[model samples]
Target: MKRTTIIALMMLFGISFSKAQTSPTAEDKIHSFVSIKNPPTFPGGMAAFYKFLGENIKYPEQAKKENIQGTVFVSFVIEKDGSVSNVKTVRGLGAGTDQEAERVLGLSPNWVAGTLDGKPVRVKYNIPIKFANKTAK
Candidate 1:
């Protein structure tokens, strides 16, 4: 009886360990940005751009008070050389939301370069930023 119990526990442990090692699915990879080449260039790179947003972004106080929460989708092009350009809003909820999205993206730092056919290529990327009103809670 003791040997049987030990073998059962070992089998359970092996099964659980194998399950933990499985790879993530494609959907799990969507939210992250991975560059094929070195990091791309922007006027100020990501840090400077984020700083610009931090300085300029005004949280819609009214929206926050009302607990408005939504995701803003921003699309922009990254040049072949890795420079950020042509930023625009693909989706927005308003309440000064679109402008806010544009402002944040425009101020984004350069991204790591992308590649096509193993060569550097310009690509358009889209990102969604979520805003939640903590005050409402």
Candidate 2:
């Protein structure tokens, strides 16, 4: 009986150990691109991307009224699944331009995820959003 109980316990322990080894945790799944072979891309290209931005960005009324014009810098992570996340302003222009920049970026479609050694990985990208007030001098 003692020997049988010991064997059963050993089997249970072995199974649990095997399960732990096979299952990866969230920490192990982080696939950020510190060094990458290729950069991420939009669906069409850079020109199309800029065009999309131009078409989508609506000049904030407050900004237009105040004649605020400058560049807003934004940073975000393009995940391995081609989804954008962690969007933030690295540098911001006031008069509602900063919030507008964040809004426009949040509306952006997923980009082609970056590649590290041919494997898809999350990459951090920074971009400057230009705010030009055509009506203002």
Candidate 3:
């Protein structure tokens, strides 16, 4: 009787441990962007997108003059249709840096949407923007 009770308790604990180790289902892990439908292609790839940012982003003169420098982390949802939406700054520095990061992300042309199980899926991407002061020789 003692051995049987010990075995039963061990089985119960094992079952509970197994349950805790189970991963969440795909549906449960889906992000909000997955529910919204979007377009199929972005105008350019990553290289071109970066080029756009370099060309368009204006480093704040005041910040640069003061030698303020930091990285801004921007988060956005890439829709299944290749369109980027819900642009926001996850990490930021003051001195007009975060706004510039948001502006650049918002202006980005679509991107190649990510896929899961051979179907387009919304994915979250984080972009880091850096600002540095340029010194005159």
TM-score between model 3 and native = 0.63
Give the candidates in order of lDDT, highest first: 2, 3, 1
Tens-digit per-residue lDDT, 1-137, candidate 3? 99999999999999999988897656434354334354233456656777888898898776776677878888887776767777899998878888888987888776776666667776776678887666722
Worst window of 10 by summed lDDT in candidate 1: 26-35
| Local accuracy by lDDT, each model | 0.66, 0.84, 0.74
Task: Extract clashing residue pairs from model 2.
Answer: none
Pitting candidate 1 against candidate 2, the one with the higher TM-score is 2
* Candidate 2: residue 121 Cα off by (Å): 0.5
lDDT of 2 by residue, 1-137 (tens): 99999999999999999999999764235443455668788889878878888999999999999988999998878878888788899999889998888888788898987776677777787889999999896
Which regions of candidate 3 fall more than 4 Å away from where they truly are? 1-44
Count clashing residue pairs in model 2.
0
lDDT of 1 by residue, 78-121 (tens): 76656667788898767776787787676656665665456556
Model 1 lDDT, residue 115, Cα: 57
Candidate 2's C-alpha runs over 4 A off are 1-35
Q: Which number leads on TM-score?
A: 2
Query: In model 3, how large is the Cα lDDT of residue 130?
Result: 80
Clashes of 3: 2
